[model samples]
Target: MSRTTPATLALDRAGVAYELATYDYDPKAERVGLQAADALGAPPGEVLKTLMVKVDGRPACVVLASDREVSMKKLAAALGGKSAEMMKPADAERLTGYRVGGVSPFGQKRAVPTIVDAPAAALPQAYVNGGQRGLQVRLAPADLVRLAGAQVAPVT
Candidate 1:
């Protein structure tokens, strides 16, 4: 096993149960969620991706299913913001200390408001990036909420 990443470190410190899954990563892949699902033999819906956006000039982390898109209007309404836009890849990397495909809700370089799709709360477990590409962490949704200080909302 390699050294724990920021995401895994947060999970460990929170006493959250999780399984680490690592695989060969292809940088050219277009859809990272689909690739991870295929590699892990899991359903696409069970694998969620973390997206960073600027909500009312502040950073907010949005976690949604790999198969779905974040509803910007709905997210704005839920966040009490007039609008939300996806952060630039460079800004996201700078803010989270993780690259585009490897953004995780926990252990970001800075604490940001986080919102998770309601469906994630219904799942027994979910696989999210482990703070780096080619690695993922399988953990309980409740633990994710607690660790990220995320509110459950309908993000898609």
Candidate 2:
């Protein structure tokens, strides 16, 4: 399958090293990240999930391990905000210019503050959405942090 998405293009432009892979996307799965981890033969910790959230009513991007859950309290503290919550699917799609399951932190429509969980940062490599359903981009965690200007924090 062609992997030339906005996310890929952004990586290309940045000259960052990355790889792409695809899997059978299960829309019916309870958690898309878990399904992706299982399908990719990767540990859940190596598969990162990109979540669109609002911190004090403003949008932000959060990257963390699929096996972990973001603590809203920690998220707020990390971003220096008073409160945080998941953005509505439609709002997230609109803000990021990607469908819910396909949202990638690499090439959002508008750049927002980003945070990479400490767990993901500790990984040598990690996988995140490739701006499309069933597609994943694998790269060094350091590259992700650099490319996204993401603050590393213990949000999970």
**Of the candidates shown, which would achieve the greatest TM-score relative to the real structure?**
2
Q: Highest lDDT: which candidate?
A: 2
User: Which tens-of-lDDT digit does each residue in 28-65 have in candidate 2?
Assistant: 99999999999999999999999999999999999999
| Clashing pairs in model 2, backbone N/Cα/C closer than 3 A | none
Tens-digit per-residue lDDT, 51-139, candidate 1: 99998888899987888899998888778899999999999999999988888898899998899899976789989889888889988
- Point out where model 2 deviates above 4 Å: none
Candidate 1 least-lDDT 10 residues = 1-10
The pairs that clash in candidate 1 are none
TM-score of each: 0.96, 0.98
Q: Estimate candidate 2's alpha-carbon lDDT, on a 0 to 1 scale.
A: 0.94
Cα displacement (angstroms), candidate 1, residue 27, comes to: 1.5
